[model samples]
Target chain A: MILAVAWRNIWRNKTRSLVILIAICLGLASGIFYMAFYKGMVVQRINTAIKTEASHIQVHHKEYLNNPDKKFVISNTDSTVQIIRSNEHVKAISSRVIINTMAQSAKTGTGVKITGINPEDEKQVTNLSTKLIEGTYFEEVKRNPIVIGEELANKLNVKLKSKVVVTLQDMQGNLTGAAFKVEGIFRTSNTAFDKASVFVRKSDISRIMQLDNQASHEIAILLDNNENLASTNTSLTEELSTLDVKTWREIMPEVSLVESSFGITMFVFIGIILLALLFGIINTMLMAVLERKKELGMLMAVGLNKTRVFTMILLETVMLSLVGGLFGIALGWLLTFYFGYQGIDLGTWSTAYESMGFDTLVYTQLPFYVSMQIALMVIVTGIIAAIYPATKALKLKPAEAIRIDL
Target chain B: MNVIEVKDLKKVYNSTEVKVNALNGIDLTIEKGEFTAIVGPSGSGKTTFLNMLGGLDSPTSGDINIGGTEIGKLSSSKLIDFRLQNIGFVFQAYNLIPVLTALENVEFIMQMQGVDKKQRQQRAKDLLIQVGLGDRINSRPSKLSGGQQQRVAVARALASKPTFVLADEPTANLDSKSTENLLSMMEELNKQEKITFIFSTHDQRVVNKAHRVITLEDGKIISDDRKNE
Candidate 1:
């Protein structure tokens, strides 16, 4: 009966109740949608980091990462590649001869990290070949073909088929330079990576530096699925014990941090939104309790106990909150579904977003469990908001309240 | 048999600078099945006496024994239970829960007493019918007239089957016809069911209908008149 009465009481002032309900609804919907948006952006960045920048895992000469000197090379790279290819989870692997050098164009010069890779092998490990905005991937030029980033091309004042000179130190620590024609200009989301890195044929760089073709400074591996990353990384670490093997997470800790701390960030964001809505609920319930002081007094005088009175008020607040919360969740879910499929284009701010390695077009993503958790949070907020008003109702003296005239 | 016995009932209101005695040294007893009225002017403590008798307020120094149990000695919670079990109240404003229908308003007290659903529902229906509100059972208080709302209040007060009903100017807001109808209905219930009724009223209509009248002046009972005796 108390439950019935509590439910009816909410509609006593339909306008008042709906005002608070809408406040709660819109508040939660915005919070949930914002959370989904941010999660989508972060997930996209991590995906880009793995697929386009750093493959699932990488192996290097134990000291090559700490000191990028050409002397620190993984000897017998052909045998290492063969051993890695034996793993069922390994989708593709590529060996790279890396050197920190300068690329001088006809107009200007800039520092760059030149990566020498077998075009076919590198194509399987990274999606750079697919990101070509200009020429073919090492097809047009017969010798010393290079694929440079759009940002690097802009900075070096060079275009497709432009001859650029790469200055570097050889394996014997002697100054060496070579001319390579830009075969392709690729543009990735990460502007910084695009500006600083360039790729060329591994044989051409090895022949020029008088280095052995069987030695490599870095070995990149791509897995069929991210779920196999840990297992494949561990297996490769054990098999290639003499080399330094690391996953993408260990390679890019900043991106890993964004992925790992997303839950806490969302929780805090939603918490603030709920906290603001808490006061609105409290005020609405307080008005309801105060307005019915005389009626409540009559109930007490007629034998309704304090516990039942408190329970009635609590139930009213919770029911109100739950109704609005469910609607908000439904609305948020609908919005997420629509945008997740069609994607939200942040084209206006694409430059800022792309500079930080985030795709401008983001597809909202929120797991089912996250929406469930938000529902639970709404219930908890209702309970907390009910306490003060319910307690105030409990403090009314039946003798005085009954005669309060209003 | 005496249903309520009061010995030297005294209630003093102590404020920061004043000590106004609301009830001063009253002694009285109400018999079973009696229709009595406690009448007085404003601030004469008639409401205070009724509040104390209903166990809604505590006395400064007194003993109020209702049906062999001393109400003053009960704790706040136990006093509430005691009121639920032994007393009924009807206020002037017809303070029914506006959200509930007339029938639900009547059944609410019985529900609070943990009465089973079917039994309480049936009794609530019977009580509403007895109050001449059988047709308005499904009407909320806001939809009913002032007199009809008071009738619902009376039905609710009687649903508990309390030892006695305390009515504080129940007809104060009613028209002459409604007042007469309500007083006659109460007289009939008192005569038929032998249910005791104690009222604090300023209306002469209620005073004329009572079998006994107790008048107060300056927080003291100045006259106790019995009509039939």
Candidate 2:
């Protein structure tokens, strides 16, 4: 009976109840959509970093940490690659001969880390071929083929098939210069990373650096299962004691920092939205209690105990909040799912997003746990919001309340 | 058997600016099956006395003993339980819960008593029928006439099978015909069920029909009259 009364009481002022419902629904939708957008942007950053640069795990010569010169080339690169390929979880592995050099075009010169890689191996590990924006990716380019980022190409004012001079120190610490023709121009989500690196053939760099056949400075591995990242890196480190192995998270701590900080940012955003809605709910319920003071008083006079009275008011408040919350969650899910498929294009803010290491095209992805957490948050907010109004209703003295006019 | 006893009942409305004595040292007793009217002019303490008697308000210093228990000594929650079990109240405003039908309003008190739904339904229906509102049991208070709504309030009060009924100006808003009909029905119930009916009113029609009349002036009983059959 109390539940029945509480349910009917909400419809007493149909317009007011409807307005509250709409407010809660819209508030939740906007809040959840914003959270999904943030999550999408974060996920995009992590995927870009892993696919275009880090490749899950990297192994370097132990001496490279102290002296990253040409002298620190891996002593047994071929055997290491063979061992890595034997593991089922090891999806792909690429060896690289890395050299820091200054590249100069007709227009300008800038510092760059030139990576020498086996084109087929690099293709499997990083999918470097797919990022090609212009020309080909080392396809039948016989001599001195190089791939540069679009931003770097623009910075140096160079185009496809353009000749550029790269100056580096050889094994004997003597300045060595080589001219290279650009075979590919690629662009990635991170403009800073794209502008700082270039790729070339490992055989060409090994001959020029005067290192042994199949010798390289770095080994980048892409795993079949990312969830095995920690165990795989640990196993590789223990098995190959002479080299240093690091996961993507360990190799680039900034990406991990951004990932963890986003969780807190999501909670803060949700809290602010729910707090604003809380006061509106409390105010509406308070008014309802005051408006029905006489009726409530008569209920007490007719033998409805204080506890029952309090529970009824609380039940009404929770019903109102949950109704709105459930609708809002449904609305938020619809929008998120639809946009997750179609993707939200922030093309107008592409430059800003790229600068911040995020992709412009965000696919709103909310995990099931996040959705459940949001529902729990709304229910808790509802229960918390009901406390004030329920207490006020409990404080009314039935003796005097029954006599109060209007 | 005496159903209610009041001893030196006093009620003072105290505030920072003034202290008004609403009820001043009143003493009274009501026997079983008595239809009594506590009549007074405005500000004569009739409503205050009725409120104290029903355990709705505590007296400043008095003992209100109903069914051999002093309600003034009960806790707030205990007093409410006591009222539910022993006393019924009919208000002047015909305070039937507006959200409920006449049947629901009548069933509410018995529901609060934790009576079985089947028994509560039958008892509520029979009470509404007794009050001549059986046909309008499905109607909400807003859909009923002033007299019909009040009759529903009366049925609601009696739903718990209380020992007594306290009606405060129950007919103050009724027409002459409705007032006469209400009084006749209440008198018949008072005799048939052997239930005590106490009311505070200025209506002469109610005072005339009551078996006993206690008149108050300035918070004191000025006349206590009983009608002989």
Candidate 3:
């Protein structure tokens, strides 16, 4: 009977219940949608960056990571190759010879980081070969030609077959280099890469830098399973007999730190939204309790007890929250799915995003737990919000309330 | 046996700056199976006295012993339980839970008394029929007439088979003819079921029909009269 009374009383004023429901629904949907979008963006960037910019692990001489210019060769190149070949998960290996050299066109000259690799193996590991736009790929030309970044090509105004001079410091600390024709212009979807990286053949670079019979600076390895990243890196280093190992995260602490901070930021934002909705629900439910004070008193006087009254009010609130939460989950799911499918075109900001190695379109898909979190938040808050109102109703003085007019 | 015994009872409602005495040092006793009426003008402390006797309000200092227990000393929750099991009430406003149907309202008190649904249903139906409301069992308070709603309230008061009932002007909202019908039904129940009834009101028809009458003035009893005796 107490439950019946509470149900009827709630319906007596429909407008108030509706207002509270709308607030809860919107809060729930916004929290779910925003979390999904931000997380999707992070995942997308990581996937693209891992696929195109860096491999699972890189093996280099300890000095290669720090000094970067030290061409001091490691011993047992064949033994290191044996270690790499022994791991079947090590799908591909692109040996790189990196040098900081000045490139000169007839009209311009600029400093560039040149990376030389085997054309077939490099393509198997990175997306660079597929990005060739205005010129022939590295596989097409055999004159030991250079593949320039799109931005570098623009700055130098040298298309395919254009003559450009390259200079580098030799073993004697003297500048030793040679001129080569421009084989291709490639853009890595990352402006930083397009402005800086210059690809050449490993043999050609060894001949230029006078390191015959020696492995290049680093061996960038791709693995079939990504979960082996840190472990493979360690094992590879242990087996290399002469080199150090590094995962991309270890080599780039700033990126990992940024990712961690973004997580904290998302948690904080969700906390505020949840707290606000919880209080809103409580305030609204308490007002309902107060307004029905006399009615509750009448029910008590008619023989209803505190426990029954408390249970009744709690049932109403929980039911309302479930309805509102389920609706919000459906709505939020739709909003996220629509955006994930069509994606947002950032054409105006494409260059800026590409500078960071992101595609022109941003697609966001929510994880399963994000929706669960939203549902869990609503349910927890709903139950918590009911406490005050139920307590007040249960504590109502039957005599005082029974005597109340109107 | 006396169903209600009030010995030197008092009640004080304390506010921020003043205390209002609703019931002041009074003594009264009412027997079982009696249709008694408490008569007074407005604000003469009749409602306060009734509330105390029904265990709805605590005495400032004294005893309200009903069914061998001094209700004034019992805890709040115990008092509520005692009231549900032992005393039924019919308020002046008809106080039927407006949301419930006539039958549901009647069954509510029985439910609180921990009666099973089947028994409660049967008892509620019989009481409603006794109150001449068999046809209006499913009607909500708003859908029923003032007399019919009062009938429902009366049915609810009797649903628990209490030792006694307190009716605080149960006919205040009824028409003159309907008031007569309601009083007759109460008198019939008092005689046939041996259910004790104490009505606190100023209505002449109620006062005359009751078997025992008590008049109050300024929170003190002025007269107590018996008709059949």
Model 2: C-alpha RMSD to truth? 2.5
- Comparison by TM-score, 1 against 3, better one: 1
User: What are the runs in model 2 whose C-alpha is more than 4 Å off?
Assistant: A62-70, A82-88, A234-242, B16-18
Tens-digit lDDT string for candidate 2 (B49-149): 88889888898998889989999899999998998998888988838878889999999889899999999999999999999988988999999999898
Q: For residues A34-109, what per-residue lDDT tens digits would candidate 2 score against the true structure?
A: 8888888888888888888899999998878568777777878989998887777899999999988899998899
lDDT tens digits by residue: candidate 3, B1-229: 8888889888887865788877778898888898999998887888888888888888889898998999988888787788888888888773777778999988888777788999889989988888998988999999998888888888888888888988988887788999999999888888888899999888999998999999887788889999974
What digit string (tens of lDDT, one per residue) describes model 1 on residues A159-191? 988999988888888898999999999999889
DockQ of 3: 0.45
Candidate 3 similarity to native, TM-score: 0.86
DockQ of each: 0.69, 0.67, 0.45
TM-score of each: 0.92, 0.93, 0.86
Order of quality (TM-score): 2, 1, 3
Candidate 1 Cα misplacement greater than 4 A, ranges: A76-90, A210-213, A224-239
What C-alpha lDDT, on a 0 to 100 scale, does residue B216 get in candidate 1? 96
Instruction: Please tell me which model should have the higher DockQ, number 1 or number 2.
Output: 1
Give the CA lDDT, 0 to 100, for residue A63 in model 2.
76
Q: Note the Cα lDDT for every prediction shown.
A: 0.92, 0.88, 0.80
